[model samples]
Target: MKWQNALKDYQLYLKIERGLSENSIENYSRDVKKLMVYLESHNIDEAPTTITTEIIQGFIYSISKSVNARSQSRIISGLRSFFSYLVFEDYMTSNPLELIESPKIGRKLPDTLSENEINDIINAIDLSKPEGERNRAILETLYGCGLRVSELINLKISDLFFNEGFIRVTGKGDKQRFVPIIDVTQKYINIYRNEIRNHLNIQAGFEDTLFLNRRGKQLTRAMIFTIIKQLAEKIGLKKNISPHTFRHSFATHLLENKADLRSIQLMLGHESITTTEIYVHLDKSHLTNVVEEFHPRRQSLKK
Candidate 1:
């Protein structure tokens, strides 16, 4: 089959069967498209099913020179999944990447901000501007609720449940969950909604969108990153940070305070407990405290 047709089918499968988000689907499709470009540029007339391991290896080798090991590993994984899907659908007899292995790479821990740093970043906001209250609310929601950038942008007015103290979040794969919201976060959101958002000339179809651009359209993910970057710069934060930094801080702080992994996992909407375990590594003291507080031999060890 042609590479284009195969890619189209793979995207459909990702959406309909796997229920992947549009961003994820785009990333997966891009991996396959890269291989197609490689083949076409080299004048190698190989179809999706006919492409050999040697050709695939050449494509990978070419990319490894430019990308870091982590990014290269992700591309390899994406290609493996694509071929595996083909095999599942009888498009191929076996997966070419079945024998290939990803490069050895250490687990990269996420960067987190301390409470002081977070407070400093929030305090740097210019409240004199019209978007000032809105910006403060955005940061608060991002850190307070442990939301992904996509989730924060897509949040709707109807999703707020202040009386119940929960804000419904639509996480990756379109899965929905209700996360608890603190009174402080609610107050900031109310200020934005009443003072800033309500006064904007909201365009059609964006009336329900909780966060908006100056044009009354929904905020983009890039805009969220820019806002955080500017705040970090204003506060002289030397560390590189993005919208996801707040999420990492939220998870890490919860672990340090002795919150259970499963609860944090659910709040972050992670599908696996293993993903949440990264926070345990962020603070080894938490593990030590767990053993000190709960272990049966702790009383004897005190002696």
Candidate 2:
């Protein structure tokens, strides 16, 4: 089969069968495309079904010089999934990547902002500008709710249940969860809606979108990054940060302040408790507190 045809079929499988979001489908497809590019540049004529482990290994070796181990591992994983799909469909007898192993790498901790730094970043916004209120609300919601950038951008006005103190979030794989919203965040959103968003000449189909560009269309992920970058620069923050940093900080701060992991996992819309456990590594003090507060040995000693 042609490489492009296989890729198109794989994309459909990811979307229809796996129920992956467009962003995830694009990432998986891009990995396959990279391998296709390498094959073309080297004049290596091979089809997906005919490609050998040796050729794939060579492709990995070639990319090793350009990308870090973590990235190479992800590409390997993506390709592995693609071939596994083919094998499942009876196009191949065995998966070529079955014997390959990912590179051993340390678990990189996420960057987090302290309450002071977060306050400073928010305070740096130029409230005199028309977009200032909107920007402030955007930052507040991001930090307050621990939202992913995609979730924040696609947030809908209809999703807000302020009286119920929860906002509905659509997370990875189109899964939905209700996350509690604080009164302060609600106030800021109300300001933005009443003062700014309500005035926009909203484009068709964007009327329910909570955040909008000046053009009254939904905000892009890049725009969210740019906003955070400028805020960090304005406040002279030395640590590199993006929209996800707020999410990390939210989870870390909650853990430090004695919030339960199960509660945090639900709020963050993490399908697995393991995914939420990364925040546990961010605060050594929380670990100490846990031992002191609940460890049977420690409790007996106190008694």
Candidate 3:
């Protein structure tokens, strides 16, 4: 079997069997292609099933000059997944990357905004402006639903099942989940739709799109960032915030308010509970209170 055909089949497997998003599939394919190029340059030709660990190590060494440990780590993981799929399909008897060690990199926490800071930023919006209502709704939805900016921008009007207190979110890999929407957020979205969105002449193929620019086109990722940046600037906040700040704030606030970790994991669409553990850093007072009030070992013998 040709290497090219194997790569093609692998791409399909990632999309259909593994159920990765388009962006994720592209990244994995790029990583494998890089390996293929490296082997070609060294006058070594091998199909997917014939690849060796030494060649993989050589490829890592070649890229080490220009890539950082974190990025190299990601590429190594991608290649490992590709080869593992080959073994799963019986194309190979052993995994080439099984013994490969990924470089150690400490977990980097994402930037978060305090609830008060988020409120101050949203309060700074110029409500009299044409985009004010839209911005208000955008900010509310971002925090209320803990949505990724991509999911927020591509959000559809029909996807808002507000009457049922839920919105259908299309997350990574096109996985769909029902996220609860509070009445307050529902009110803001309704106001924006009736009072602001109702006036715009929406573009074709975007009539169902929840948010639109002045030109009636769908909002781009950059536009979403720009909106958040402007709000942060207006409030004189300096935390290097982004559209994702709202998401972080949502999770942080929920944890602070005593929400369950498992529920937060599901709401955030995280693949693992470990990913949701970062929010634990956002609040420790609850734990302190619990320990002070309920720990029997610490209770006084007189009591």
Clashing pairs in 3: none
Which structure among the candidates has the greatest lDDT? 2
Angstrom error of the Cα, residue 70, model 1: value is 0.9
- For each candidate in the order shown, give its overall lDDT on alpha carbons: 0.94, 0.95, 0.88
TM-scores across all candidates? 0.98, 0.97, 0.89
Estimate, for each residue in 1-303, the C-alpha lDDT of model 1 and write its tens digit: 988889999999999998999999999998998888888888999888877788888998989988988988999999999999989989889888887778889999999999999999999999999999999999999999999999999999999999999999999888999999999999999999999999999999999999999899999999999999999999899999999999999999999999999999999999999999999999999989998898989978887
RMSD of 2: 1.1
TM-score of 1: 0.98
Error of 1 at 198 (Å): 1.4
lDDT, residue 27, candidate 2? 98
Q: For residue 152, what is the lDDT in candidate 1? A: 99
Candidate 1 structure lDDT: 0.94
- Candidate 3 regions exceeding 4 Å error are 1-3, 234-236, 284-286, 293-303
Poorest lDDT segment (10 consecutive residues) of candidate 3: 293-302
Residue 28 of model 1 has an lDDT of 95
The alpha-carbon deviation from the true structure for residue 184 of candidate 1, after best TM-score superposition, in angstroms, is: 0.6
- The worst-scoring run of ten residues by lDDT in candidate 2 lies at 99-108
